[model samples]
Target: MRILFASSEIHPLMKTGGLADVSASLPVALKRLRHDIRLLMPAYPQALARAGKLESMATVTLPGFPDDPVTLLSGMLPGTRVPLLLADAPRCFQRAGDPYRAMDGQDWQDNHLRFGLFARLIEHLSLERTPLGWRPEVVHCHDWQTGLAPVMLGMHETRPVTAFTIHNLAYQGLFPRHAFDALNLPPELWHYQGLEFHGQMSFIKGGIAYADHVTTVSPTYAREIRTQQLGNGLDGLLNHRAESLTGILNGVDYKEWDPGRDRHIAANYGPEDFSGKALCKTDLQDHFKLRGTSGVPLLGHVGRMVPQKGVDLLLRAAEPLLAAGEAQLVVVGTGSSALEQAARRLAERHPGRVGVHIGYDEGLAHRVEAGADIFVMPSRFEPCGLNQMYSLRYGTVPVVRRTGGLADTVVDADPAGLKAGDATGICFDAALPEALTDALTRALALYHQPDLWRRLVRTAMAQDFSWARSAEAYATLYRDLVAARVPPGKP
Candidate 1:
């Protein structure tokens, strides 16, 4: 099978979140299955710097984009033989800071145009116009950044199969009406059956409305987004297309997350001999400058401090626990100015008991997973969470709200669940602070029972959330898609 995976970010080259991790790892996994997979992303300064040797391939031009003659660069993914395509449009990507934002947190005003050119590049590549000489039978896109590819593909009389994965529905890439004029899209796209959502044009709606098939990050999320509460007004479209939609949970690259060989943690241990976890706990406490013994429970959090993640719930739950000195909390993330300030204020209020690092550090994230007795993710809605999976692998029991992928992955640590020997972590039903605290309270109580706690840790460690199962599922989907694309008279 010949496929091209398109995403805004690719790990080790450029990254802002789990999308990059998926973009990088999934292709590698697919390539291992003996499929010809090509990876496509824009040439951000970071991607260009890390990309090994680059060969100029072809130049591209989009109708609305004034920046004509954007160059394309071809290279290989680092440490792999897989081909990589980089759209070298300086005006669009060669800005300061990361791919999506500048040094200031505000989005670049011309993002619609920026990603417009990127989608155009994908369309051209999917058509095999470049010198790289590989035509993709299937073009799989990720998120709203590549949403326009499906819309653009719809215009072709004989185009390859297209699949679009919605990583997050909340970020629909809603652009103003004026931007649509700048996009130079077909006027018919302005209708509700196309890209238009209310008064604005949605980049995601383009994919959802026209793609050959659609996917979310998890099976539970696949169902959730069909509801008014979680769909963000796309429920009708999602429900209509439910037959073509699938939910494949995101997988972790255990080579980067495994505790047995992790270079980031203070100590390494496996399920058989996890005595080193206590040392990691002590080191984590020391790093946070918290006064604590190994006996004290430590809760860990790593992600955006946005309301969607229910960070407010986490804060509210932490207040009672931190005030009573029941446990120590360590948070590592950067999002929402108000949440950042609130996390710092909580740290200040509790001094040594609360440690908040208002930024992302990959190494520190691994240490938290390896060290903390409990991993907290109280997301109001999670599509498919990666950290909870990492927590399970690290033997750090996760405390999560029963929603989306969190619901699919974590097994609630109720008495019946434990007795049945299937419990992997703690789960709360409601997305409320009190619900989270109740789950945490249960986790803390369970922590005092050494035998039960050790059993739970081993159970978590024993579970597998690696790429193999999910990759096989994707490979099956790709095969089905390719078969479906064949003409009725042909094989």
Candidate 2:
């Protein structure tokens, strides 16, 4: 199979979240399955800096795009043979700060035009086979940023089958109603069935309405998005298009996440022995300036400090938990100004017991996974979370809310599950602080039981969350979509 994997971000190239990791790992995994895959993303300053020796392929000028010309750059995905394409338009992508945002947290003003042009760029490259003589059998779009490709492709007489994967539904690429006219999108796309959503232009709806198939990151999220609670206003449309929806769990690149050979952590340890984990714990405490012995339970969290992330729940529970000194909590990554202030304040008040870092560090993330006795994610809703899977691989028991991918990945350490020797982590139903605290209480109890803790860790390590499984599923999906689509000759 030949695939043009398109995304706004790809790890090491440009990453704001898990989508980049998926964009990087999935293609490499697919390539191993004998599929010819090409990765496409913008050539942001960060990506260009990291990209090794990019060769210019072609220059692209499209109708209604920004005046700046887009130069297509070709390279290989680092450490892999997967072909990489970068749309190099300096004015559109070479901004000072985050890809989607300015120095302040507000989104870039020209976002609609930028990604509108980007979508057109992808469509042009895939349609024309500009760089090389390889045309894709499937044009796989990721998230709302690439949503326009599928809609535009559906109108082409000769075009590859399209598949769109929604990494997170909450961000639907909504622009003001005027964007439809400003960006010069066809007036027809302003209808309810196309890109328009409740009088606003929604880039994601383009994919959902026109793609041959739609997918979310997890089976539970696939179902969750069809409901009003988690849909973020796309539920009705999703429910109408339910049959075409599929949920495939996101896979972590175990090669990068494996504890046995992880160079970022304090010590290397696998399921076997795991003695180095103690040293890692000591290092974690020392690094956080916590005066705690290895025996104290350490809770680790890494993600945005938002209400959705359930960091609020963690903070609420921490008030009582940290006060008693039963455990030490360490958190890294920044978001939500109020939450960031709250975290800093908590850390300041309880110096050693509560350590907080307001920015993301990959090395520290790996250390948290390897060193912590319990990993925490109390998400109100999650779409195929990667950290819980990472914690499982690192033999760090995850305490998570049973929603979306967390539900699919973690088997709660209940009595029956424990007896079956299949319990991998602790799960709570509600996203409330009480429920989270209860799960943490359970995790602390399990921590005291060394034999049980070891069992859980071994089971977690034994579980396979590798890309091979997801890649196979995606390969099968591509084949099914291609076979099921109307033949180029007929319709």
Candidate 3:
């Protein structure tokens, strides 16, 4: 299979979230499966710096793209043999703090133009119109950034099959109505059945409407997006195209996340033994400036401190337990000024029990996974969270809200699950503080029962959420799409 994986970000190059990790890992996994998979992303300064030596492949000029010809740069992804293509349009992607945001945390004013040009590059590659001479049999697009490729491909009488995966529906690439005219998208695309949503132009609709198949990060999320509650106003269309939509749970790259070989953590540990985990916990406590013995229950939270992640809910729910000195909490992430302040305030109010860091640090994240007795992820909705899986691998029991991928992955530590030795984490049904508190209570109870906690931790560590199976699933989908491709001039 010849596949082009298109994303706006890639790990070690430019990463804002899980999409970058997936873009990096999945392609490597597919290549390992003997597929000729190439990764495609913009040539941001960070990405160019991290992506090793490169050769100029080709230059492409797309109609109405407001920039010089895009220089296609070919290289190998850092630390991986997978071929990498960077659409190098300096004016669009060369400057950035993150892919989507600037240094001051504002969305880049020209995102529409930046990603629009990237989509054009994908179109050129998919249609085999560029001098690079590599035509993908299938182009897999991720999130709203690459959403326009499917639509552009659809304009041709014949083209590669397209698959679009929605990482998060909340980030639908919506622009004002004028952007449609400004981008010179075909007027036909501005209809209700096309890229238009309400009175605005929606980039995400290009993929949803034109792609041969649609996917989300998790099976539960695939179902969740069809409902009005989680759909973010696209539910009706998703329901209309339900047959073409599917969800495959995102897989973790064990090479990067496994505790036994993790160089970022304070100590190394594995499923067979967790002696190093105790040292990791002590190190974590020390780093957080908390005075706690190894026996004290330590809870960890790592992610953006945003409403969707339920950071506020976690803070509120854990207060009583922290005040009681029954547990300690350490939080690592940055988002939402209000929530960051709240977390810092909580830490200040409880000097020894609460600790908060305002930004993301990969090493600290690893330590949190390895050191914490319990991992907390009380998301209102999660597309396909990787941290819970990481925690499980590190023998850190996860307490998560039952939604999206969290629902698909974590088995509740209930009596039935415990008896069957299938319990991997604690799950709560609601997003409220009360629900999280109850789940934390359950985790604490299990933690106090040393034998049961040990059984649970071992079970968690034994679970496999690796990329081999996920890569195989993607390969199958690509094959199916190619098999079903309409013959040229016959459709």
Candidate 4:
């Protein structure tokens, strides 16, 4: 099947989080499965400069917004056979540093206009009858940034079936209703059944309302988002489309994350030897200037420091845990001034007990995964996280909040020891500091029991959450969607 996978970000090109990783790895995996897959994203100046595809292709202007003509650029994605189409419009996309941000660290206020335009361009390209025909059988939209694609397709006279995947529900791309004219969205789509949300235009709602299928990262999150608590206000719409909604758990790119071949870490080790992991642990300690001790369990967190990630809970639990001195903490990744300041303060208070790196370092992240005894992801609501899976691959037990993908992935340690060999990590219910404390205490206690800890590590490492498996599942879904399009008796 010919598939057009649309996402705002792609790894090794423009990545801020796991969405980019999924966008890049999944398409490559699908291509390997013999399906013709093409990727569509903004030709950010940085990406173009890196890929060496700055030259312009065809310049096409939209109907409503005639003043802005978007230039299309064609290039092969680096390290992949799939073709890439970049929608270039310097006024809309060209900015310093990151694709989504300026050098001064501010989001482009015209993001709504930018992405909406990209969606419109995609619809036009797909529906246009050109000599180089490229009509996709399936148009897969990733996250809210590209959510407008499905909506635009539904409004158009296009035959391509649309699929929308919710990587994160919290960011729904809600813009003022007046911007509707700028979007060039049809009048008929203004109603609640389409893109309307309250008095604003919701990109995510449009995708949910119009797409043939809606998917979240994990099955448990698929169920959770239907409830008011976790839905971030889209629960009603998701509940209405519950039958069409499916949760497909995301998988990591084992080639990039596997400790066996990772050159980023101080030492490379796999399940066989396992001794190098300890060396990595010591290296991590030395790197962070923390106490280089193997007896105390080292817990690591690598992600954006924000309330959504439950960083506040980590802060609350830090002092007590450090005071107890049973375990050490190492946090990587940066976001939210409040969280960064708090983490840094905690590190200052307990020098060797807490190590906080207030920035993103890919190499450091891999080292943390290999070295840490436990990986902590206390997210308040995680759609589908990749780090926990990375931790599992690195033989690090994950201590996660029992919500969204975390609930789906981590099998809690059996209290009665009934499922001895199967348990992967510690899972907590409440998204509070006390709950996190309790879970940490349990993990630290288990760390002392070498046999149990080893069993947990082995169990986690044995699990396979590779993109190859995920791609196969997606292929089946795509084939099914295509088969449904066939006439009743036609082969």
Every candidate's lDDT = 0.90, 0.90, 0.91, 0.85
Cα lDDT tens digits for candidate 4, 344-399: 99898898989999888878988999989899999999999989999999999999
* Per-model TM values vs. the true structure: 0.98, 0.98, 0.98, 0.95
Consecutive 10-residue window with the lowest summed lDDT within model 1: 60-69
Q: Assess candidate 3 and give its lDDT.
A: 0.91
* Model 4 TM-score (2 dp): 0.95
Could you give candidate 1's per-residue lDDT for residues 219-323 as a string of tens digits?
Answer: 999999999999999999999999999999999999888999999999999999898888898888889999885467999999998999999999889899888
- Reference-based lDDT, residue 186, model 1: 89
Candidate number that wins on lDDT, 2 or 4: 2
Candidate 2 lDDT at 4 equals: 95
Per-residue lDDT of candidate 3, residues 1-491 (tens digit): 88999999899888778998899899999999999989999999988888889999888788887455799999999889999989888888888588888999998877888888889888988888898778889999999999999999998977889999999999999899877888888888889999999999888988898999999999999999999999999999999999999898899999999889999988898877779999899999999989965567999999988899999999999999988888999999998999999999999999988889899887889889998999999999999999999999999999999999999999999999998989999999988999899899989988989998999999999999999999889898898888889555663
lDDT of 1 at 156: 94
Enumerate residue pairs that collide in model 1.
none
